[model samples]
Target: MAHRLLLRRFVSVTLRGSSGPVRSRSSALFPSRSSLSWHGTGPPLHHQAVPATARGFCVSHASRVTFNVQNQADFAERVINSKKPVLVDFHAEWCAPCRILGPRLEKMVAKQQGKVIMAKVDIDEHTDLAIEYKVSVVPTVIAVKAGEVVAKFVGVKTEDDLEVFIKKLTCT
Candidate 1:
């Protein structure tokens, strides 16, 4: 119990230091004020009873699969020349939208395994690469083919948009 609280504090502090705004875990884990089960790091957060006053935060229970890239060289080698079109998401751990978009992307990749590959770059950590790609946001998803970027979307994007972009990327 104590460990959970401490971990939650650590997460909150870490998120505050990152680019995106931190969301209330209570609001994230719970939806309405009427919860079936109750748990707490700081306070009891019910899944169904999260009041609108809980906060303007939303957490979608989705799967977001990501590949962590170490540096520009590795990214180039792994994504640029890959047979499958690579979708790189430039994000930071703290970003809210990045968190929301993460799981959705995982499901998307799973559904379109042969046609697309999804990767992530921590812009905060990989500053140089993010700058090279001209990524000015927390969640910039880029579609690359034949070592060149074919499509780019800054901020949250739909899976359908990614699918269409991948289909359009030139295989050079």
Candidate 2:
């Protein structure tokens, strides 16, 4: 019980500063106020929820299927030249929409299994890729296949809309 309380405090502290996933054993024992659920040993905590009033608290989640684009060469090798279609999310750490959309996009992409791969690129960290891709805005999603960009969009989108976009790209 003491450990659970301590874990809860840790989660609270971690989330108080930034909006991201909180992994706590207590989260499984004691459900959070938000929509987080425990599904096995290590599922991405995308569903982890913190209080809305919590300052700097944002929910972030990533799946094992997702990859973070580290640099220009990595992008070229993993996304542009990959066998599967890659959904590239160009975003920034300070972007609120990116925080909201990040986990949601990961969830949606995970449902596709291996049919698609999601790549996250921080605009600040990978400015070159963002500029080359013409990502003037944060939360820009680009679909790349066979070394070419097939479709791209800006801003947040509903899960359904994103699925439709992926379907359109994969169907071709």
Alpha-carbon shift of residue 95 in model 1 (angstroms): 0.5
Per-residue error at 171 for model 2, in Å?
A: 0.8
> lDDT by residue for model 2 over 1-172, one digit each (tens)?
8796566666566555555544444453455632244456654466444452323433343455698998888888899889999999999999999998888889888888778899999999988888899999999999988889999989999999988998998899
Model 1 TM-score (2 dp): 0.56
Overall lDDT per candidate, in order of appearance: 0.68, 0.79
TM-score of 2: 0.64
Runs with alpha carbons beyond 4 Å of true place in candidate 2:
1-62
Estimate, for each residue in 1-172, the C-alpha lDDT of model 1 and write its tens digit.
8798666666555545556433455544443532334355433432222222322233332223346888888888888867777788888999999997766666776676456777888988899989898998878888887778878877766888655555565343
TM-scores, one per candidate? 0.56, 0.64
